[model samples]
Target: MRQTARPAHPHLLASPAFEELLGGGGGPATMSALRASERSWRLLVVRAVLDSAGSAPAGPLPPPADAWRLLARARTVAEEAVEELLAYPAVGVWAAHTLRRLRGTAEDEAPLWVHTGHLHAIAASAAVRAGLEFRTAVPVRRGWAVLPALGAMRVPEASEPSEWAVAEVVARADGVRVAGRGLAGPDWHPLTELRADGCTLLLDDSDPYRTLRTPAAAEPLDHAAEWQRLFGEAWEILCDTGTGVGSDTGTGTGSGTEEARALAAGLVSLVPRPRAERFRPHSASSGDAYGAALASVPDDGEQLASTLVHEFQHNKLSAFMHLFTLYADQGAARLYYAPWRDDPRPLGGLLQGVYAFFGVTGFWRRRGHHALGQFEFALWRSQTAYALRAIGGADGLTDLGERLVAELARRLEPLLDEPVGARARSAAELAAADHRATWRAHHLRPDPGAVRAHAEAWADGRPMPAAPSAFGLASDGSTIVPCAPARGFDTRAVLLRWLLADPAGFDGLRDDPGAVVSGARPEDVDLVTGRTAEALRAFRARVLGGDGDPETWVGLGLAARAEGDAAGEGLLARPHLAMAVHSELDGRADPLELGRALAVADGDSL
Candidate 1:
């Protein structure tokens, strides 16, 4: 036991020291050992080459051929060491540490680390390729961590490891501030002084991407010192200003005035000088926490300032509309083409007509104007209606509603007119004619007597006599009246039966043309006509199935004196017209088999 201990293997001799350097680790220890072995082997190879090269020749006479051979062997050993070192565990730990440090830097600084690290590696590789022996024992000095926060030194370069140059550049800019030693570590740059109004430029020592505030909306800065000073001044002013509604009165006047002035100045600075006329603080709505514009009235000068710009657009548009329609009010010769002012129903009709026209013309298929119509309709039906209801009635406001409706119609009409094709005009005409015919037939043309009788019967809580049957003649032979046979019928069938059975009866009943129809009184007829006109329009389009001018039916029924209790006679005449049209369009009368199948499919007891 006292005898000299056997010498440790050459590999084991270095293992413990290498492990300690690598920090005790499974992969890292092994890697460090391999690197140690490679370095030792390379050293041995170099030693052997030198030994074989013999003593240096006096006066360096003739280059030794053996020196070249030894040099080649040394090069091979160096290459092998490099390959082994790349796979070393210590290298992996070093790389991981570097990456962690890079990521921990400010977001803007992180990119600099990446680029600089790449450049450093490239420089080292070039030096090694040039046969410059790198001292791996001496660690490369870590450059200043504060470079990125100072908004300087964007990229790493071999000659300039220090980021002082970048910091100096930003320090000289206006409205920027630099704190601490620019070459210091992470804590050197602080964002505590950053403020919206104070700083026109900011070094943004704080992590740009990590801020909870919206980065897109944030103003960017260029000079550190200038931005810092600006930010501080703005913040101080804002803090000193009064924001309360009554701050301008009495004891608060001084403070309030200063606050108002500061706020006004801040707002002015935000708007471009060219658009200053359009900028107004009072009209703009404040944004929500997420930076979206909201409809709520703003309490702060900043919010009000933004809102003014938006409201200005609306005011401008309203003025434009007023000017565009000035000609319409000039004289009696003025063409009163404003649909909404004349009739509420016309607005919808015009919109539908314009939309259909554009669709047929295939012009600007996705135009914003076309989509706006739907929005306008929804606004009228929902928001406008609710608003009107809240205001009780529009009794004193004679033309307000009408004017709004007309403006909407006018905006849509131009879109339709731009196409200028037969189909477009036809669609528009049909829409207008349909609206007018429906109004006239349902609200204006019914017999006064019939309307009065119906109302009286309703007042007395009694039903009017049953409507006459389709085939029945009046007791006086003066008229024929057709009643609805079923709750719903093929409109074509109903029309044909009525027309054939009562062709002459309606004409006979027209002697006292002004008289109201039986069962309905005069005033009652007028009210019913007005109330049900829109419904009648729909019924005419879908049931009667006529392509002819709807006015013809109105005139015929009124002029022929068929608008009394005998009004049923006029109703019957519609079916004949429908049938004739259908026959002409399809070249056949109702197909019995097809009708029967349809009835069965519809679950009808036909």
Candidate 2:
């Protein structure tokens, strides 16, 4: 086996490329750096396996040295094929997961060889692609030998699903065989690709490690044609017909084309996730898997287009992070709040949400001619802007992180002034305010002393106490605390979407909204559909009747604010404080009067 010398210098992103990534898109230079970073991780994993051969636990496969020799021989036959195999998304996932397990940094219960022996399967695939004659033992789980990007072979006669069995992979110039079964038979499953225009992607469904970072349940490929058709439609919306490639105009005929071009260049594989609730597309990406993403089928072409852009933005930032440190290591605390999520996020997670939504903002900005697009553009642009400011002012950011945040803010600030009609603007504001108020009420625990003082004073008919100086984000700071649903705020957001996209359909929901959406209430439908006066009465009634849902308080605040009431600002700004005081009164206080008192006591600083 022949070995090639590794590059002496570490991978780095040039200034221009880094700025391009910050501008909400990526290009060949950025993509190449990410791919190289993934390759480095793969090689690092292989080296770690070799070095730890002595202490690694026993399993069904050959020794680490023997497997390494087999992979080395394949590299000598076809260096490019071997590198490509190493850069495969699942390969990166396996490499990172295995390296963590091997170094004792991660607590994995599986035998060490179960992870290391994936090298043999990768080698076998490379040998087959190179047409090199070779034989090696690969792990078979659940009667299947998954060859990463190549495909999988069903070995029915192998060991039980709970245990790993070693299967012999013998390859020749003609074809490959697993356990004496030839590749020409039905037992061998080859991966398929979806092609449209100039964009091609591996529609990965069979890879064992294809689940990415989480253990996702796989669906049958019977609906493959439907997914392909939806993908083709999404491609039509995302295709770049402007400049040859990497050209994002941000306006007019070719706006978002550069982003589309970038998506095509960097996106290589997609794993189909189970269909999400409401048929909305769900997507996830990992820094370990640079070019790959997992997503459920989107409900429509517009959704598909945005979903792809969102996940690809995550991939771009992840890859960029792989090349450079963004923030110093954060201790174990998920303290920051992300507008898009209900739970408290860590600093790094907040940065990721900002970057991903930056891409989403760009997508809607380009499509702002329609009401749905305008509303989304208005909503996400504001949310993303706030998050950028939060992170920019945050401590622990490296010099590079500060620069990236500044560039992103510079690019996004202009969009804030872009007109999206008053109606769209109003709906966007309501939704954003609702989400913020609901998040605070759900996650931010009021200071107990302030709560008691305010409650006692209100009960005794004295002046209310001042707002709490600080609120605890979680009871336990070490891990992410699970949060209840966003009350009716999420339902209201959905109704707003329906109102913007399908008004007649939304009007039809006035009679019975719960018939359409399971948990949607009449007041929510009325609130989003412009019946503010009517909805205000209903929301006020709900709050006065001791309804403790945070959404009720937020809804009342939104309605009152729409009518320019000063008291509403207190509820919108400090719902956590209001809820604590309300609990002390046992829901007997008047909603507007309570809001007015809180606003007065807080000195209008709320």
Candidate 3:
């Protein structure tokens, strides 16, 4: 058998103030509270460390084992001091406040400095407890004292010092040569020594955290002009190749570079369009680029610029639909398609004229298919019909249906003609027939009164009657009526009917009792009868203090009620009609429905 993780010991270590608050108790009852207090302290320390490290010089630290040992020793000392304050509640509170203050000070500084700062704070406090005055000082080596402090306390370091000697490097000049090793994947690392010339290059074999910070190499012009030139060069490269090539292969060959440079120049000269933006390109090898948002033209600018314009047109059309109609939020108004990254060949240019025809039809439908409901489905059919007309009768009409009829017709048209073009014309004629059918369907009118009633019911909680009015009859000839239950006993009866009549509705109640309760109106008694009996059973369980088996029966009654069942049968079967009898005897049944249900059920049982 697998062993379960051991629960945290409350007395092993905790803030003195916390122990005092719980009256110095170390029992299981206080375990959760102790754990919460410990968590708060840990969060405070972590935040402090992160804050202090921000201003520290960027470089690899001493081995992790050495640092961890130093911190662990300091924690032991703090724990002892807290334990000593168990008898003095006021002192314990003061110590906790002081610990929080020290944490704040450490975090406000560099995060890397926190370990050293904490050691100093603890040592000073210990000295004060031992009746010796201690003064704070800035140690010459900054964070170096932490290691020696751990050593003095006989704490063993866990990590090898050599493993932490990572370095980072950067490029300096055009002609400088450098050899790198082991610097793969997504982190920055130090390169080999810089050449006599200004060139700086990345080293392949170095620690990942190691980095070199150098001034950006001097250009012939100002910073703004240099960035502009670079942006132009990048843009030209992208436009010419129609791809994002920089993420792989590093630098391209001479001709490719020249083409890229030219493209960039053109990009810079073109006026910045309203929607287009710029962004820096990054490589997978550098983790710094992982979540960084680089400037770039929006909408994944890999497609031809014209495609961007087309997408903008779709956005505008969607906005207009939202402004003009009620069902605008139903679904996507248009689908955007782009050639697969590895394949740039346009769909319109492939498969001879068939592909071009399909593209035109798809685009046209996207632009004008504004009919709602089944009419939208018809418009889709029309597109298929157009395709079939172009193909001619090559296939059969055996699979003709409201959907895909045009495609089926187009396939059939090819069989009627040797030339694909003649087949295409035949398919087009069949498609036009479907399109006409769709147009006629779009003009069919719905009952205006029903629509208005639905709209009102949705917007405002108006209680609609079961029977339709005269206006509804005139508009739709026949209106489907819904059941509407009255207040109190009648509503309870209706609920019982629904529970027996619709099992699916009861299933929903089982899945989510809260939803059922929320949907019930104030006049509805079925849910109240179920819920009240449940509350009473719970109260009884608390009063009698027995095992959970009786609570299970109460839960079953609640489940039945949520499913719209009459709780009368369940309550009558139970032994506790004594409370119900007493409630009825006191005449409390007059105002409260729950009291009334209990009185009636109990009286019948008696």
Candidate 4:
């Protein structure tokens, strides 16, 4: 008799399928498989957590093996319910955090048992979902016992308070009870789901492991209805089949419908972050959390749609990285300047950013005729292309990474040629250049010997020597550079946005720059609004008077370049060099004259 062939144990992407994902063309099936792979990885991590728990110092928490046994028993009762519990994003985050603690790579933020005891809660949830009769003890944190995918229950008052309390979970076909109280009562907060069309998102704000940050004081989500409506509209935008807002200049592939399907499959929930400034969108995704995107309230449906797409792209790529080693050890420590980030990023991080922004580009490309859409499309397309070039030339890519980068480049090439309006294009260029120069100023230092040599020439009344060939990465003895997030308001960028999105508003700011933009001077408004000559004069004064403002230095270069001053090119391209030479001169030289001399010294014809 012929035997039946066995299928692949865990789903693996074939070469063609992998290439399709790299080119940004994957749907629900693709996402499901990636999630399955992630689930397998989480299981392996869970196994590791169990294996290492025995060697550690014992604590008051329940045994890891007991929790694992309970989970295994629940799986036998109902595999689907067990899988759902394991697949909840918080489970992955918990497992990763616990594994790090077990291996001594992370801090013991909580008792090791508290970390290992989460498995018990997950098991209880699975048992409850499966309608199986079981009893297990779950950790009560802050008087609440959280069951993954279920909800949280407030543990009854104990005789004595401790850092952690063990609550008994009893499940049956009728219902589930925690610490002798039924979940049907008012003490339980069930995970809320926001459903639009066929897509469902858990608007999770209750789980303790919902975020990687230190647990904040949990407040009631008073804005749940607004979030539900916004999510509904955003889902509609991603699923709408209508022609997009602007003229179709893009040759890019894929539609909002496909994106919506894939996104719905890959994105399990949205965890609300702390409220941010009005109209500003903020979001983040972790590799450990495969299906959740932590996001702040967005200004509108369009903003929400783009933010979801941007973060889901990160989640998707993160899943792929779990399955494949894209780059080798040699490239792991090498940092490259990212156009969107102020700090230097490693090769892998650069790839993640390119992939994430590529999704953002596609989102705006569909609406590239609208004013804001045109500006965003132009901005991210240029930035992504710039970063891709860096990735293509960087060392230490495995065969897989090479193909992935090639596919990304191939898809981005046509988008680069797509038409954008003159104003948006100029703003994009200025924004890209500003960020590049600012990052270089903060993170890349010019050679001290070369800087000193050039400074000496200026002091001795000699022609400036040739500019140093290149700058070195600044670091404080660590392999990674020590850099902080970009400090202060980006006044020029804000003005440019206003100039593109709301021309009338931008014009209104011309008279008083500080009216809307904090920390903006009159020259800052003038620079972005085309009063380059006036702005150049103000910037020179600021720099000459010992104002080491990064924005001033960059703005000076932009204004000078617009006025056909070649001298500004050197300062713009090498703000770190300009700052160094200025420091060497002790701020005695005329900023413009120094820029002019440096321009000639760097071989730029003036």
Worst 10 residues of 4 by lDDT: 242-251
| Top candidate (lDDT) | 4
Deviation (Å) of 240 in candidate 4? 2.2
Residue pairs in collision within model 4? 246-369
List the candidate numbers ranked by lDDT, top first.
Answer: 4, 2, 1, 3
Error of 3 at 204 (Å): 11
| Model 1 local distance difference test score | 0.27
Reference-based TM-score of each model: 0.16, 0.90, 0.15, 0.89
| Local distance difference test scores for all models | 0.27, 0.73, 0.26, 0.74
Please estimate how well model 4 matches the true structure, expressed as its whole-model Cα lDDT.
0.74
In model 1, where do residues sit more than 4 Å from their true spots?
Answer: 1-153, 156-207, 210-254, 257-606
Superposition-based RMSD of candidate 3 using all C-alpha atoms, in angstroms: 30.6
For model 4 the TM-score comes to 0.89
Candidate 1 residue 85 Cα shift, in angstroms, is: 44
Higher-TM-score candidate of 1 and 3: 1
Looking at candidate 2, the ten consecutive residues that score lowest on lDDT are 470-479
Q: Write the per-residue lDDT of candidate 2 for residues 247-336, one digit (tens) a residue.
A: 342222334455466677788898887676452357888877878888887778777777887888888888777777889888744367
